[model samples]
Target: MTTFPIYQIDAFADRMFAGNPAAVVPLDGWLPDIVMQNIAMENNLSETAFIVRCDPATDGAEFHIRWFTPTVEVPLCGHATLASSFVIFNILGFDGDLVRLQSESGILTARRDGDAIVLNFPKQPIVAEDIPATVTAALTDAKPSATFRVASRDTDFVAVYDHASVVRDMVPDMSVLGTLAERGVIVTAPGDKPGIDMVSRYFVPAFGIDEDPVTGYMHCVVAPYWAEYSGKANVVGYQASKRGGIIDCTVDGDRVHLKGNAVLYLKGEIYLAD
Candidate 1:
């Protein structure tokens, strides 16, 4: 049997049980695709991140990372990436301040800044598109001021509301929305409180998640969208899920900086029969 270390981390949270939970597994080499998928399913979290060493470097962090949901593999996942960075930097004894990872979406980096880890991710651009009435109807009694579709490869519908309360109170009909887009839907509005620039909630039933507590990846689109409207490069977003979390966003040219805190929840070993 082969044993591997596994860590459960709460990403984008200041404390345990408050943010999105992701399982991070660091591997020596590539595991079978089915094996990694099975592990993600067994974990049953929003996402599980797997990292493996690259190109003749055993200890170097030039790693290749992949993210999986319970049911499917996704192109990009933010919280899981953050959790992976936390595991590599804090738990795995990496001395560098920045960790570079290669994924399906492209090259990504995570930089440690005091208590929070700042993720440098690509900015997803959005364009105004005609609202899908079906999506609007799924969100009953919560009509949006405007709606848009992401122009990037990971296409997600964006719904804009006038009030943060409306965005929070939304109860999307997952059954009706599961087939709407390739990724999911993002509903957002201006923050009601000070120091909070925007508030958002993500629903991706197609990806086996009804709602993501604190989504780091979606903000790649959210931060830029808000910046164009608010005209501020630095903005803070709050994910208004049951398990609430915070994300500090900064838009720079083609990149979006997502900064948040993560807490370690568990460390254990998983056995694989040889």
Candidate 2:
């Protein structure tokens, strides 16, 4: 029998039951792709992260990371990445503050900032697009004031509303949403509360997640756009999901810095027969 250590972490949260929950599994070597997918399906969380150790040392170590949803292997994932870093730095007791993770999207780095973990990710390109009738009907009740496409690791259509309530109150027709795109849509609005620059909700039926409680990937695009739109270098985003979370976003040149906290919810082992 083979046993694997598993940890469930709530990322982008200050406490339990707040941020996005992700399962992190550390591996000495790569497992079969099918096996990893099966593990993610079994976890049934928004994301499950698998990290294979490439080298071990006292300083920063390198690892190969991949993210899988219940249905598909995603190129990039934000909250799961944070959880993986937390496990490496806090739980695994890595000596250095930085961890380099090589993924399908590219090389991504996570660094410890006081109590929060900050991820350095490539900025997504945002371009104006004509709002699709199907997307509008599937995502919201009314037409968006403006629409854009997040062209990067994954293609996500962004629908911008005027108020945070509009984004918060939406109940998307997932059936229609699933059929329209390979990924899904992002519904966002200006923050209703002061100190909160923006608010958003993410849906991706293709990934087997109807709605993500908190998303770090979407903010890669959302933050930079808001920086240019609202003329703010640093912005705070609130994800108004059922289990809400907050993100501290800073847009640097060609890269975005995402800062959030993660808490360990459970630690156990998954046994497998050899």
Candidate 3:
């Protein structure tokens, strides 16, 4: 049986229990797809991140990362990736404060800054597309001014709105929405809300999550899109899921810097189920 260390961490906030929680599992080497998938299902969080060695000479471990929800696998997950790197450098034995991850998304970097984990991700730049009528129905309160889509292959809309309240008042029909697009939908709006610059919400009724607390991958596309739209260099992002989180965002050329605090919640070992 493969023995792996697992961690539950809250990402995007300094205070414990205030951010999105993700499970991190660092493996000495790659596990079979079925095993990794099963392990993710067992952990049962918004996302569980699995790591395997790639080019140890580059760092200490060449890590291939994959994210899974309680129900299925996801293409990209920001918070979990941050949590995984934190565990490797902080909890595990990595010497430096940064770790490079070879993931589904591509080469990504995570840096430990004092007490927070900052992720440098490729900005999946968004271009405006025609707003579909189906998308209008999915976001009841806000109508998208712009749209972009991303699945594993083809992503869907990065729907934009005029105001945060429009995003806040959204009452999406999840049943109809869960399967709307291949890559699901991301709904966002600029926030004038106190304590935050912007507020957004995520839904992938199809991906088996009703809402994601703090989404790192979505912002890879979102930060660049908004930065261009607002002509701003930096901004704050808040995911309005029930278990919410605040993400600090900065645009730097082709990359978007996502900054947030992550707290370790639980740690233990898992023996593969025979």
Candidate 4:
């Protein structure tokens, strides 16, 4: 048997069980894709992140990272990336305040800012798009004011509503949403709470997640949209899931800096057959 270290972290939350939990595995080298998939399935969280150290001169990144859901590997993930950076900064004895990770999406950077970690990610630009009949039918009770799609990767549909209460009370039909061609759907509205600029919820049934508690990647799309709408470079977003989370977002040109806190929940070793 071989043992590998694993850490479960609640990203975007100040306390345990308040934000999205992700499993972080630091590896000496690459594992078979099937093995990683099995590990993700075993953890059964929204996402499991794997990291391998790389020579910056050769690989152009300090670490290479990948994110997997219980069912499939995704091109990008926000909360998991923050979790991995937490492990790197706190548990793994990383010396610097910033860590650069190479991923399928692109080069991503995480920096330590006081007690929070700021993830610098590419902004996912969105454009107005006609809502599909299936999506409209699925959200029959709470109709969206407008619909938009990510222009770059075309991964998710953005549904905009008039009020935060509509977003908070929405009950998505996962069965119908899972059949959509896109990876997921995001519902958002202007924030109703004090100090909050916007509110949102993410549903990615196709990737094996019905609703993500607090998503960082979803904010990559919504932050820019809200910034443009509110005319503010910095904004705070609250994800109104059962386990809520708060993210502070700053939009700078094509990049969005996501700032949040993470807490370690579990630390142990994974035993696997060699």
* lDDT (CA) per prediction: 0.90, 0.90, 0.78, 0.93
lDDT of 3 at 260: 85
lDDT tens digits, residue span 31-114, model 2: 899999999999999999999887535324488899999988988899999999999999888779888988887789999999
| Candidate 2: stretches off by over 4 Å | 56-61
Task: Please provide, for model 1 over 1-274, each residue's C-alpha lDDT reduced to its tens digit, 9 standing for 90 to 100.
Answer: 9999999999999999999999999999889989999999999999999998675265334789999998888889999999999998998898799888988988899999998999999998888987678878897677788888878864788999999999888888899888864668889999998999999999988888889889988898888988889999999999999999989999999999999999999999999899
> All candidates' TM-scores?
0.95, 0.96, 0.90, 0.98
Residue 192 lDDT in candidate 1: 93
Report the Cα lDDT for residue 161, model 3. 82
lDDT of 2 at 62: 89
Model 4 bad stretches (over 4 Å): none
Query: Which residue segments of model 3 deviate by more than 4 Å?
Result: 58-62, 150-153
Worst 10 residues of 3 by lDDT: 148-157
lDDT of 4 by residue, 242-266 (tens): 9999999999999999999999999
Task: Give me the displacement of residue 217 in model 3, in angstroms.
Answer: 0.9
Better of 1 and 3 by TM-score: 1
lDDT of 3 by residue, 245-269 (tens): 8888999987889998888999999
Positional deviation of residue 75's Cα in model 1 after best superposition, in angstroms: 1.1
Clashes of each: 0, 0, 14, 0
Any idea what lDDT model 2 has? 0.90
